[model samples]
Target: MTFSWRRRRSGRGGDGKSEVFKGINQDMELTIPTHFRCPISLDLMKDPVTLSTGITYDRESIEKWIDAGNITCPVTNQVLRNFDQIPNHSIRKMIQDWCVENKSCGVERIPTPRIPITPYEVTDIRSRIVAAARVGDARKCQELVGKIKDLAKESERNRRCIVGNGIGSALADSFESFARFSVDAHVNLLKEILAAFTWTFPLDEEGISKLKSAVSLRCMVWFLKSENDLSSRQNAICVLKELISADQACVDGLMGIQDIEETLFHTVKVPICPKATKASLVIIYNMIKSSKEKSGEIALKFIRMGLIHLILEILVDGDKSVCEKALGVMDSICSLEEGRENAYENALTVPLLVKKILRVSDTATEFSISSLCKLCLGENESALVEAMQLGAFQKLLVVLQIGSGERTKEKVTELLKLMNLCRDKVDCVDASMGFKYIKRSN
Candidate 1:
């Protein structure tokens, strides 16, 4: 609806006709002048402010327009003189008066808007948090942390202010500093620190490195086991993922932490958060992708902990994203003979792996075939018979006819040939067929 109004002149240019907005109540009506509404939002101005062009707009709408890199005025195409929003108290007060006058017509008055906190204020909070940490006063530090959280939630402008000012480094420094703190204080402090990282924008390379160096591995292990709050636990895992992922040396260090391994296994089975679960899984996958010796050790551990069972369960029940990760983790672990032994022993392994074929993404397809090929080609004859009895022959025929990537198709063909030779020995196949996709390039 277009609402228009003209200024009344001292002469007879004034018209008795007034624009009216009828409320749901038949007797109640309100009339908002066009000048009072923002051109961008088409809503009554809550905190009207004048731009460099002397054009009035709601402070938030114009501020966002400027923040988004627009230099021209919304109404007039003139370039902005400067990106300043001077508060127009006169117009704001007029809007408030109008809302008050129309109270019976269901038009509610807007509440006072809080100004965004400045970088100076965030820097001051960081100092207070540091001073509190120096004095070992957890209470004061916690209060300051709560204040930071409140300021961060106030606005996107305040959030950028927090990041631009060094809150990430402050939190990382604080986390490392409080390692020797009392148990309750340490856990509480860790929770707050992770909260800051989570709610703040993402960390830069320097900030991530600082946080990774500050990570106390022992405390994180205890956190995974002892912290009852799921969010805190998930935060701990996220921190580990960043630290371990940044450098291969960090992943090597984490491999020795038995508690880290144990808790990761626990999380895979009983998830705290979907993200945490995936991070935990990806960490193991990263370990497997690292040095061969270390990858084998982690794979054996995963088998002993029955992580394969949990992975298959997720592949069957979880979303496609989680399924792809699970498949990758499985493929990584299956590089070890012990891993292959455990997988083939499980009755659901081959069938479930086969079920994932042509169902999930192409990455899932490659991993599934790679895992099966590992078990069948390397050693375990018993695993080979298990694959056959579980309908591997039928699945391979379908796979050959439909086909995938050249390398994947090559692996499938090799498996078909290998299993075909063992047919009479295992006696597990009904029939076999050949396909043109398997033909060698001339």
Candidate 2:
């Protein structure tokens, strides 16, 4: 996006303002040349960029467009192969020359565009980061972190480049490698790694896969337990959050770590930040996502760590996102017998599950129903009584009659069948609606 900067803008009698833009006067609103205008802003492009689809726009406008999560070219609506936008140096030069020609009329030359760091350069710096971490050189690590921070600050493009060139994977590898160093060295190394993540180098799938090593997992726990560096701990949590969500394989590996339960519980029990809190919950969900046996074991550990009560606290006070994730973990934890027993014994459990039914999004509703099915599908009288008192039957009737998803409706049927098995004792949702218990649809 480099453009010549020799020209100057003409101001209105030393008012120190750009009154003339190329040949168009700002006050006059004269129709400027269309080619010089950025399609997005419909004004002259200070730094024009050309997309792969051959559409040119002002740098700021196009970058904002890409950042909005759009994958298609704005003008053509064609799918983009990548988010990379090429700098139209020639168009920029033309605009600058025009500015210089009109300088007598008060137009000012735009400064040359700042080039974002390339992926090759990013790859080189990231290798250096890993090298520094390998030797546990504190100063070198800090300097590399500073360099990455500058790259991330330069443009959104550089941030993408950082991820594309595999810096995220390198950081994960660094975390693992640093574990061989002394505790203080590893902690310092982790802090620098976290500093890089603050700019949010999005980890790619390959990176997440490579991060599954036992050493890396232990390092993450170590970070969560750090007493000295709160910022690094928060960043570590953030990194863990992204890393865990990337792959079930990574999560499955962390299962062997005996102390992970305590670490994850403490993380959730007293999160350093909202991001960390959400990450803590997400990591638990990852652990329980795979197998029912695994789920039961993890649930037992979570119960031991008082994860249930902590989740309830989070549910009540958390924002929609945290509440949804909390519900997700609750659903998994409640699937096993230990989880069910723990949940049934808790006073807040049934009521909170019912409260979340339609209070959150459809995903929350799904988890709530699933958890309820696990809790109510047995001869657990206490759970049944809680549901009856909490008006859960009425809610189920509303759900069925109002047309819930096919799968949720099936879980509701199981709930009713269980309730009617004790129909002689409790007044439940009347099966008189001729609602036969339907098998749950996958």
Query: Which candidate leads the pack in TM-score?
Result: 1
lDDT of 1 by residue, 140-201 (tens): 87788888888888877778888888877666656666765655656777778776766554
Q: Return model 2's CA RMSD, one decimal.
A: 7.2
Provide the lDDT at 4 for model 1: 41
Compared with the true structure, all predictions reach lDDT values of: 0.74, 0.74
Question: Which residue ranges in model 1 land beyond 4 Å of their true spot?
Answer: 1-32, 44-49, 59-68, 131-137, 181-185, 245-249, 291-295, 379-434, 439-442
lDDT of 1: 0.74
| TM-scores vs. true structure, each candidate | 0.78, 0.75
TM-score of 2: 0.75
Tens digit per residue, CA lDDT, model 2, 1-442: 3222332334435454423354434443333467887778766788888888888998888888887988898889999987777889999999898777766656678877788777778878888977887776767877777788777777776777676787877776666666656546556656676667655546766556555677776676677788666777787777777766666666677778778778778878877888888888888887766646553576677776778888888888788889999999999888777878887788888999988877887788888888988888757777876776677777776777777788898888777656665555555545454445445436
lDDT of 2 at 435: 44
In model 1, pairs of residues that clash are none
